[model samples]
Target: MINRRTFTALMAGTLAASGKSFAETARGKTVFYASVGTELFLYDVDAEAAALTRRSSVMLPAGVQYAWPHPSKRFFYVASSNGQPGGGAVNQGDKHYASAFRVDPATGALTPHGQTLALTARPIHISIDGGGGFAMIAYNDPSNLTVYRINADGTLGALVQQRAKPDIGIYSHQIRTTPSNKTAILVCRGNNPADGKGEDPGSLKVFGFNEGQLTNLASYAPGNGYGFGPRHLDFHPTLPFVYVSLERQNKLYTYGLQLDGTLSRDPLFMKDSLGEPNNRRAGQGAGTIHVHPNGRFVYQANRNSAVVDFQGKKVFAGGENNMAVWSIDQKTGEPTLIQTADGHANQLRTFGIDPSGRMLVAASISPILMREGNNVANLSAGLTVYRIGGDGKLSFVRKYDVDTSKGTQFWSGMVSLG
Candidate 1:
């Protein structure tokens, strides 16, 4: 028997099958996309079945580092570079850029839309404002931020110049604007502890937003930002709270949003993201984070894809590789860990939940050699899909493997058909 959500999807598919224009399709239908190196792969997502079918792929100028969909849902911005992961350059030339693509409403096919803007450095993160009028980008190496105007034709325009400020924190990981479009926050994941080096402090740099111009507001951190390494953050859909993922410490923190466009000086709540918090392990850190669209749950990725040499063979270092599901207390904005679903693959770098809050897709970036008993083999990169339950839990549905020998699967996201 077809349930309500499935029934709605069937009706929408039926209308599209009956020759309805692609633009006329229901806006609730969703499709997923992943960036594997310089290639972009599109998928048709089934919300009820929690499945994905590969559609096609498109090529970009260089390797994809990050991507952001416009608020209009009709366009997407992709940042590409030749730089490889870790502390070195790939020497593919410094031809880094941010390109725009047109989204085909029905099939999720992408076509180049406008001129690709040359970027000064690799963009660690990029996001469009709530109003879809500006594209805000964050760079990591020598941290900086820039805002570009979204042209009337859905293209990108020149950068909006602003006064130089010394408050931009180190290693900016993500940048996002508030729903109210009055504030912008940059998540800076300061350096981790290294040999003969002390750990660098991290903080959330807040700015006052006015038509893409950012004015320094405040930097919120605990104990002068020491021992705090925030990588990503997501705002509640309806509440004045924010969920942040701490990369270096493998924890989650919640902050209250003040009306003056600043965050609480200290976290209102702090929770461990690991399944076994007491049993410490090496090569464990938090990745991307997303709040459920309905504001009832929060999800974060726990990754451990690093390998260690065992008996002269490079084998997977055992660590948690799963999605941590946390139930949100709507009244107070606190989160409780409810479930940790195995992501099937290692190192889930990024993931996305559908706008309707019914489906989730996770992308595992790279493959590593795993030891199964005495035999060892390479685990391929893949994407996992799950169905979100009413209680804010996740039920694993299926996994789609992709050959990452050519390039890594850096990022993936679900875009609703407009």
Candidate 2:
């Protein structure tokens, strides 16, 4: 078998003959990465055919939770841990780390780049600043945030001391830097009431960032965050609007980005993410949100993977598992629901859109047995591809079934080479 070093060198040699940097020749190429346990697999994307072909893989130190590509597209930062969520546990596993990898621009193969940094808790989400000078990580167990400086050579650097300890709200789910790179936002998805506990309020923690140091700026919590729980947010490509996916309410909220690097006090628009808004289900929730590269359309995932006891075994519970499409009014920055495309999988935890805006790939976490009129069918975990039409609607293309017996398909995304 060809070793990783040899394979990387061979791939690099193929492009060296062209006498062009990876950034110069990467205009039309799109690479997709998906993680199963600690292994991250790279795939070549055929946008025209809406398909993916596996190319190579690399192993991380622990189960991969999330990853972000550097602004130069020459590196990737990955957060991983053996920790599992549930039962109010602070951290179920002892191992947590942040690792850096050099991205082989020619083939998108990942090679270890630097020493792994040990973390105190499992990192739920991670992102890099627009300038690629820092890595922002968010932890949910105790709801905290940390910023680390990225070295000039793309290696992981020391953690930057904060100007002040910002009040990170409960259950932080996602964190992102503004397009301007002057501010950061931490999405706190508070816990829903369960057992004998009361509901925890959720809020968006805003911070002023300067050279990796963060200062508390503002917190947005409507109605004291009782009915609001945002899981993710994406900024419009050219507009000042930010779209957020509400995990607990199954809704979408559009907020205005202010000049001071903070959000408006109230949402400009709040719409139900579900097609049948009135017919609610117990397990339905919004997963991730993304804006099309063209800036005219938005997409969100409606996920449901709750299980029920069936024949003395856990089986899939009925609910919507689909992608929600919206057409954005360019002038007003408003979105109108256009279509709800069937996901054909159980839980669509993550998805990616090619930089060219021609295709989409959604990943379901694991396999599930479904009841269809008393007969059960096993739906395998998969990467489902869809074609994006001119009108901004998704057409089902195909799916690649993934074997997840050893681990779950935790995270997946597309990275366009610089």
Candidate 3:
């Protein structure tokens, strides 16, 4: 049943790869928001290099802020970041608006689902528990948090819980789910800063969840010294450890996870102080925090710090740029800075580290100086690949040809927490 055209096409591919230069593949059902517009692409991880492919292109209703993928990869929900359809800003003093979209995994397209009228204030981030039964949404416009039980067909059910004032705001940044899948954590920045240099510092809050219901558990308020501004947090792939990124102080903290489903303050926390850039230390910021798969080190995007390296298990105050490197103190579970990663912009949204903690993929939430010959013109956004050596040093791999417009300025992340 083989046709001539099909045979010719197979032969052409085989002949083209006669000797060297082979194509690699990726594994896992990966999804990321095509922030600028619609059309979400999928990545299937194989073994070595990731094979670029599309499961489907979703044409959203436009202005779709972010999407939450189903753990089964069978569905996802897209939400409005600004206002709802027919129009109304997500934030208008005391008002709130948000919309949802149903995703068809088989075809890779999005369909309008429902709208929440005056439900949430500037609803931005959404988190689904590991059990795949419930969802928690962070409404920053009104500094609130809400949870909803999901129906089998993807329609949201009753609004089981709602807490209007989260207290801390410049901007309620993120809501995260813990490994136990029983707790949802919220991290946020100060109100919209008119100056942009980043003021006020952020805070962290944890809410207990059960059978799709939420219970206010515990929260962290950053006092003076530590500069409380917390952003993204990454759970270790192997250890019972969690890493949090501090924006105002441009620092990192490794929190030891407790058995009762909370964070422990045992050895206090691991610290890494990013160095100055062009002698300007005040503006140096931090974004996302991610731990290497090895459980031996940690990484954070130290903005404008150039790169900071100190004793990840002990020292700080000096180092280099790109990626802030560190070593984990096994006995105390604290971090000691090792070296500064040398790469593009310090505006890394978050990084994906391999299971071995040996290879890495970093995305620039902003601009980055591209390596020679790897420049894809205006460089749109940077995707730098790297290798974490045995000594814990990060070596650059390759940067992809990208469209910088993909960078999210008005929005936080163009990705799903899954």
Q: Rate the local accuracy (lDDT) of all candidates.
A: 0.84, 0.87, 0.54
Among all windows of 10 consecutive residues in model 2, the one with the lowest summed lDDT is 10-19
lDDT of 2: 0.87
Candidate 1, residues 1-418, lDDT tens digits: the string is: 2235543453343333234333343346688899888999998887777888898988999889888888778999998887655432444347779999998988889999989999988788899987799999888876788999999889999899887563679788899987567889999988877878887789999999888889988898786778899999998765677899999888999987766657887898999999988864788899999988777899999998667887688898898899999999866788999998998998999999877788899999988889988888878789988999999888888888888888899989888777
Descending-TM-score candidate ranking: 2, 1, 3
* Cα deviation of 293, candidate 1, in Å: 1.4
RMSD of each: 7.5, 9.2, 13.8
TM values, all candidates: 0.91, 0.93, 0.68
By summed lDDT, the worst window of 10 consecutive residues in model 3 runs over 17-26
For model 3, how does the per-residue alpha-carbon lDDT over 147-169 read when each residue is reduced to its tens digit?
A: 67777766666776444333334
Model 1 bad stretches (over 4 Å): 1-27, 88-93
lDDT of 2 by residue, 1-418 (tens): 2335543453344234224443443465689999999999999999989999999999989999999999888999999989875524754588999999998878898999989999999898999988789999999888889999999999999999886897899999899988667889999999888898899998999999899988899999988999899999998765677899999998989987766668888988899999888977888899999998877999999998888988877888788899999999865668899999999998899999998888999999999999877777899999999999999999999999999987889999999775
Best by TM-score: 2
Show how many residue pairs clash in every candidate, following the order shown: 0, 0, 30
Model 1: how far residue 215 lies from native, Å = 0.3
Greater lDDT among 2 and 3 belongs to 2
In Å, residue 178's CA in model 1 sits off its true spot by 0.7
